[model samples]
Target: MRHLIRRVALAAALLAPAMPALAQETLRLRMNGDVNTLDPISTTNFTVRNAAYLMFDTLYAMDETYQPQPQMAEGTEISEDGLTYTITLRDGLMFHDGSPVTAADAVASLERWGSVDGLGQTLFSKMESIEATDDRTLVIQLAEPWGLVLDALGKISSNVPVIMPAEQAATPASEAVQEPIGSGPYRLVPEEWVPGSVVVFEKFEDYVPRDEPPSMAAGGKIAHFDRVEAIYIPDTATAINALIAGEIDWIEEVPADMLRYFDGVDTAEAVAARQSGNSMQLVVNHLNPPFDDPLVRQALQLAVSQDDFLLAAYGDGEDRYLKCAAVFFCNGPYATDVNTDRVLERDPEAAQALLDEAGYDGTPVMLMHVSDIPTHDAYYAVLKPMLEEAGFTVEVQPSDWATVATRRASKEPVADGGWNVFFTGWGFVDQSNPMTNVYVSGACDDAWFGWACSDELQQLREDFAVAETEEERMALAEEMQRLTHDLVSYVPLGQAFPSVGIATDLEGYIESPVPFFWNLQRVE
Candidate 1:
């Protein structure tokens, strides 16, 4: 009788309903590639910008309309002469470490950022001094009225002016920061990080989000998740399957061929983030050649086709990519088709003749390529045979995009670990105006990665920066675009907006060129 009672009790216990699982407020997502570092100053790519943004706050932020908005700053007072400016920090601000935010931190951050960034360097030339008058105020005295000061500070693109603690901001420009501690809403959980696997972030309880509403990178940034885990699933098929199978929450990239998979799924939805679209450009090292010769550079342009690259990178469709000739972006206000005919034309014989006139040497043209980015891989894959067919000795150097980024910075010759050409892309904000477009700046050693130098181009960009009226600025921009095509510092391949996949449960996600983890309220 006792054995029968025991069996009946065990069966009743097993049949009882399972206890409810603990309620979770975790956000699970993936990136196109692993972020290099959370260090705000060590800005390398778009993925890094989106990640570092949660850890640091800029003094000023740019809105969707490309206007500067006050963020951490109480207000900025500019002199009537536009040569002097005073900035005050918000009250009761503190870093993730519980230390008070100070003006000295802002000064140090700006000085460090100015030393490395192309636009920051430009602004620094005009900045005579950045002095901290008090614990909360910084005074920037300029040599002249620089028009792009706030724009540089508020820039949302790479090499962003992300503020950190004064001690941390003191980190060398050549070095990445050791820790991610800032006054931003999210704090890094170092213990949870698994490099090349997953990284975790937790909301800072002490964070005081601004009372303002959310906009692009500007306004109040309110964190909705208690924890965010950014997982890295390298396999393209596995990531899409994981998203579809409910194993992952979101995907920052969707391989062009798999766009149809998300059509009928009710549990998942794919929406385009960073919808401003990005354009791939060919960046060539001016330090070495056959590419060093202007004639060779121009000759390289004639043999290639943007359509070939675009069709391969994106899916089959004419609407997938725009044949953009403007380096600044075809969609922006600065766009001009002045020398587009030269870009659209494909004449290998004419290209060969130009190469002949330039006295084409058999110098090996090293094309540093990345296999990870589909578009870049597509473009370079097409460019290799095209350049070879054009009678240039081409050596395709295959590397991950991150390594390609590091290698492209070398000043040595290709034989001595330097590269002749590399691939990179930019969205609208980074290229919209002459002020932020470092590729066209022509600052010689001080220019963007490729180090293209032209004094005339420099003068033109500077003139556009200080132009008194829109008409004057537009004229200078048109001239600059025309000059860029002729210079061939970089080839504008094509343009297209890419989409990101997110769970339908995640709502209130804003449409931005840079992804934001704020203002999103979860639903069951």
Candidate 2:
């Protein structure tokens, strides 16, 4: 009888419903690439911006319409002269450590970012200084009237200003890397960051939602996830398998060809739409030979068939290429109706004629590529054959993204005495304001092609910078675009549609031009 009872108890235990693990409540999102650093000032890469969004809040956030909305600041006022601005802070706001966030902290954070030698300082160089008038208010004095200040504050690159604690800023740089403190919705869980594998964040219970409610703020919703676990899944195929097997909740960059595989899965749904702030193009090192010749650059530009590349990289009929009047602002101002088909169509004969005219006698050209970027690899593959067919001796050189970025930053010559041609990509500035991000004389240093800075371009940039009215700014921007189009610094190829995969039951999973994980909320 005791043996019988024991058997019955064991059977009951086996039949009992499986209870969820205590940690299952946390949302885990597998990202395509690893972040270089959590520091906002380090680089302007999207991976860094996505990570920072969870841990930091900017002064002004962007709304669905891409308008600026106040966040930590309760309200702001622009001076009549348009040179000075005053920002009022919200009351009862506190950092993760329960210390009150003050105007002093805001000032210090801006100053720290402005003083740093990286991209943020480059963007915010317009600011003369930020002064704290009181515990609740901060005043920003600009070198000149910048109409795009509000717009700049909402951009993914330099816009999301991560406010660091005063005490933490005072701490030495060596110690600061290990110690990160912020007032965002999530706090860093030091133990969960397993070096190269994953970084986890636990939601801060004390995180105060923006005071005037969601309607008043940009980016309509506050962070809703209780916990966010960002696992670094480097391999594309492994990430797809993990998603299909339900090992991870979501994947950021779903490979273009793998879209159909997820269609039949009942629990998983795919979200693919036109992604904003991204562009793929070929960059020529103007200082280098062959490309240094305008005719050669134009010839190369004419040889590329954007349609073929778009289909291959983004799947057949799944992508679109934009035609802008100026190379600088592809989608914005002074974009008048003109025939771009002549320039973008694959014309090998025309390309060869131009090359011959420029005295190119079959000299070898090096094409630099970052190996990890699948899209870039795909673009390079297409371009190589085209160039070779046009009677140019082309060599393709591949390196890791970091190495490529370092090389580009250092302006070093490519292997075999430097690259004459290379393919690269960039994120879009907010609402097609191309002047600030991609325009030759704008924030982008060294102009991508290592071209000598033109005085004419510099003057044009200055005019756009201080243009009082929208009409004036647009005109200047148009002229700048005309210059870039004529010069062909970098040939504009195409834009990408970000593919996202999410679980079916997940609600509030709206698609954005910029792929951000913050919008996921479970309704079911």
Candidate 3:
């Protein structure tokens, strides 16, 4: 049996073509959407951020255990008063344009990022100055003691801190960079970029990998394939078929309903992509009349049914989803249900009574429906009925994800092309702590979309940052969670465990909060 199996394998190898293999080894991957922009700091879109990970490196990165680890930095020093942080860059760091990665570039990039990001804004508020002392050393001098300095520098999710040349980093945060230049493991092939079709990248042969092994977003990022293509396929069935036919190496967003199709396929495997999964949410515009009322927001929260939303996206199976009422994820460090009983109740009568008490006069709440992304569309499809059942009027304005992304930024009235609410998702890492979560930011006009501003909530978050012990931090976190639910900062609909379809011949895929393409190699 062994001799016959060996003979068959040898015959198949000899029959295969060698021209394509020798010309250029390409790894094709299918993402749910396209990389519309190259500026990592300007937008919070996951697709663009994921693509940027391949071409950019950060000062620090979060490990699998969710702790900050140095990535581009060699070491750091602190003052006795804890108000100064001195970071030194590693040796042999070179950008794609053949320029040395210097402290001036790091300072410029961080300054630009701090102008837009929620956490970066808060960090810079207390910072006296962040200046480059030498070519390889940067110093951050704080006006007071802020405990989340490292956490702000090592943020792993959207709005990642990607170091670039000083000239490129000098651009304003409101504008997007037309072309991106980085010092990561891959270099983007500008000539092969197609707007909605495919984005290509070639491995940077000059990149120097770290000595440590691969972790979540830390350690060495080894590019095993010579070329990589991120192909966009909006249709689920077509992408799945391509994976099964060996036309693509992986699919980022695999629908739960299509899990049965891969049951008999021996070459493809569909599995959970992350350990903690993602949390779905409904963000309401607090600048408008209907949602501007706290009672109205709380009433809408009462009408939400986590199970229904999870069922619509991940089906009825509990294996793919779970009910989590905490503002932070259910199983995370600061998970608490201090004031989430009303949300878990899913009571329509209680919600209707609250709406009546608030004198809601049947105003049409405009719900922005994203047509392209299936998961976000499913959320709105289930959300509209839930709000209506509790005595509120709903108008679902249907558009693609990009249109909704642009429309959500408008603060005008709903009658004037503005929006009342929209739905989106965030990874477990983004919701792990009070300071890191964008939803928890209460900086008034400077906050994330929906703009839930409250001085009390903001103070509580600042207190959480400076808390000296775990008990003190936990207490503050509980207070913040209670206040968040009471204020209805955002509606939390359970968690969804997204799955990915990958060919069995590929290996070294990292299990992270988001999909990464480093250390992945194709088997011969």
TM-score of 2: 0.80
- Candidate 2: tens digits of C-alpha lDDT, residues 1-524: 43443333223222323312643455667654554456654444456556766777667776666677787778889999887889998766677777888888887776665554223444466778778999889998888777767655554554356676776655432122454677877877665565345667777887777644343125434567777777665555555565565556777766577777786787676776554436666766776677778798788877878777777677663543453323543555544333355356778998899999999977678776555556666777788898888778887777645445435544455553455666655655432554444435522344433453456766786666667787887777667656665566677776665577776666655545545555466655
**What is the TM-score (0 to 1) of candidate 3?**
0.92
Worst 10 residues of 1 by lDDT: 11-20
Cα miss at 127, model 1 (Å)?
Answer: 2.4
- Tens digits of per-residue lDDT for model 3, 1-524: 44443333223222323213652277777776766667789788777888889999999898998788899999789899999999999998999999899999999999999998878887998899999999999999999988778878999987798899999998998778878899999998777676566777889999999999999899999999888887666666767777776767788878788888799898789988667388888888899979899999999988989888888988866788889878888889999878888888799999999999999999888877876677887888988898899999988777776567657777788888788888877888888778778877777887888888889888888887778999998998888888788777688888888888999889899988878888998885
Candidate 3: regions farther than 4 A off: 1-24, 415-417
What does candidate 1's lDDT look like per residue over 1-524, in tens digits? Answer: 43443333223222323211332476767776666577756655676677788778889998877788888898899999998899999986889888989999999999988887877877888878999999999999999898778888898887889888878788887688866687888888776666566667778888887788888888888998887767666555666666666556677767576778898898687665446577777777778978889888888788787887778777684555688878678877888888876577777888899999999978988887777666666778888888888788888777776577556667898888888887777887788768778778888887777778889899997787678998998899888888888888887788877767777777878778887888776787
The Cα RMSD of model 3 versus the native structure comes to: 5.7
lDDT of each: 0.77, 0.62, 0.83
Which window of 10 residues has the lowest lDDT sum in candidate 2? 10-19
Q: What is the descending lDDT order?
A: 3, 1, 2
Task: Give per-model CA RMSD.
Answer: 7.4, 7.5, 5.7
- Would you give me the overall lDDT of model 1? 0.77
Model 2 whole-model lDDT (C-alpha atoms): 0.62
The most accurate candidate by lDDT is 3
* Model 3 lDDT on a 0 to 1 scale: 0.83
